[model samples]
Target: MTFVPSPSPPAVRQPGATALFCLPGAGASAGLFAGWDEDLPATIEAFALEPAGHGLRTDEEPHTDLDTLLADLMDAVRPYAGRPLALLGHSFGAVLAFELALRLEREGTPVRHVFPVAARAAAVRTGSPPGREPTDEELKARLRALGGTPAPVLDDEEMFALLLPALRADFELTDAYRYRAGDLLDCPVTAFAGADDTVVPWASVKAWGACTRGRFTVHRVPGGHFFPFAHRSARADLLRTLAQELDRRPGTAPRRPDTPEHG
Candidate 1:
């Protein structure tokens, strides 16, 4: 895959506050996290990490290699190490979130927690076999099944064509991803899944516990692959509960500059 330098969305940083970094699913961008700030209290600042070749960066080519894409994201996030950080990823984004969390922990960055939604556990092998590529029609059909894509966009030939490259690149990244075994994370992990999601089952979501030595919890929401938006009320309550839970945890405030930032 060709490396394309895309414009990054503005960083979300608030002095002396916890920051929540979100990763969107395949073929999606930071726009996936619309209205997150309103759902949570002021103490927690939410920012979405927009993947390259999508969202406002649509003109650029997407990175097909997981490592390259992650390296760029790591650099963007490294500066925020002094703050209490938590990660939230949905679907394919979940995989990215898991890998990012591990990298941060290994580098002695303090990661408060990780939330993997609508995805399998890190130990679970995901993606297509090497060199196998799905056709555009097949990809469209899969997207239709997932119900995340709008009907009009899928039906519009011109728009769909424009969306194909980034979509395909994301497929390559996820389908080609190979899991590397590593130590369980020291921070807590919360996994969420759609009870009716045919693609990723509830059992797969529960398996996220194996990736973390810290507290592990899982909640199944109603609807298909995109349950969060489908059931807004339920999702709001869940997110509000998450915020409260994080608030209750001791020492969630941003670390002092003089204090060690690692666990």
Candidate 2:
């Protein structure tokens, strides 16, 4: 699959500025984090990454396998290697973030942290049971239950038809995933769970601590599955906590230099 050219990084960055990469859940696009830059601290630069058949690549076919998706995502993110990196993903995206973190660390690029929001731990089995592929109507019902997609969009035949492919592909990938034991991540992990989410239990969210050898923290934010975007105040609090965590990391603070910057 073809990817858009990577944007050029700024010639100058506040010393130790982090490159924050974000991934969205199933049936969603990078547009999920459209206004996140305004909400994030200047020390953090947020880049939203979308899988094929979503957002700008809406015409492309989505992948039903994890390896292919990760390969493309690795290519998309490798250009930002110069800066300290962290990843934050919601639901399906959260699983991708975890896998990506493992890949990056294996290649000798240490990740600063990982934020898995509203997702069960990687080791836990999710998605549909064996041999069962959810029908389009079942998918729509799941979307309605999550309440992330608008009622109007679901009601619009043309719009929902366009969205169905990626949704199906994402579920396929999620269902096929089987965690293989390996080295635990050295970076800290902060897992977030919606206090009222019925889809993924609190115990499942808390299980993320096992993925990391570094510090592990869990935050119970208010709202349901889509809390990161659905609730304004909760989103703000989440970002604030993210900034605070980054700030606490040594050498990640902005530093002024007398020299003219060049990338």
Candidate 3:
């Protein structure tokens, strides 16, 4: 991670009245949100975060830790802080979202709300994760269980080799990642999980409630770990509902006058 800000896709309006900054899962590109479609209401704008080494700039190295990852993404999102901002991060991306919200609050950048989908609450490190990277076969098995990597990517040695670094980097990041839990988030937090996601058990996902001081709600949508794959309708409904709720309860918008803008 050379501390380069990742670029995001063009802004799309959501159906509601707020703006959404979305972060994707590890080894996944911004393209993962394509299924979201144009379901966003005009009052809301949606922007999906595209980390380096995926999608448009697939050649760059992947970032495996919070410090570098959030610093880079904050650079990408700082410019849009002028209005009420909401975070929507899934899986490992959720970890980044929690950090981003905390950092923004510390810097007086009013991140009004956050939606950490498919991730456990940051406060609870119920178990210690492996401190090392996985073997090649182990990596393949992990990827297989997630159900997102294309078969070609798994079967093609050259392609798999190219994508391996980022994928494993993500795993290492998740494993060694520690949440030095401190101040509770002032913004409301919501967690979503796939009903059948065996990887991140619902019990663990529900634990996300401990991360926020304002309010927390956990919902289980139908499907598996990559349920976002088949539940476009459910996702749209959930997103819309969440955005509507936030709009009605519009918390503090960015009040900082000196915060530097980045893109």
Candidate 2: tens digits of C-alpha lDDT, residues 8-81: 54453557778888998888988888777777877987888878889888878998878999998998888777
- lDDT by residue (47-88, candidate 1, tens digit) is 778777888688767888888899977886776788898888
Cα lDDT of model 3 by residue, 140-164, tens digit: 8888887778898899989888878
Candidate 2 Cα outliers beyond 4 Å, as residue runs? 1-15, 126-132, 250-263
Candidate numbers, best lDDT first, in rank order: 2, 1, 3
Q: Would you estimate the TM-scores of all the predictions?
A: 0.87, 0.88, 0.84
Ranking, TM-score, top scorer first: 2, 1, 3
lDDT, candidates in the order shown: 0.76, 0.81, 0.71
In the predicted model 2, the residue pairs found to clash are none
Poorest stretch of ten by lDDT in candidate 3: 254-263
Candidate 2's TM-score: 0.88
**What lDDT does candidate 1 reach at residue 122?**
74
Stretches off by above 4 angstroms in model 1 are 1-14, 250-263
Error of 1 at 26 (Å): 1.0
Considering every candidate listed, which one attains the maximal TM-score? 2
TM-score of 1: 0.87
lDDT of 1: 0.76
Question: Of 1 and 2, which scores higher on TM-score?
Answer: 2
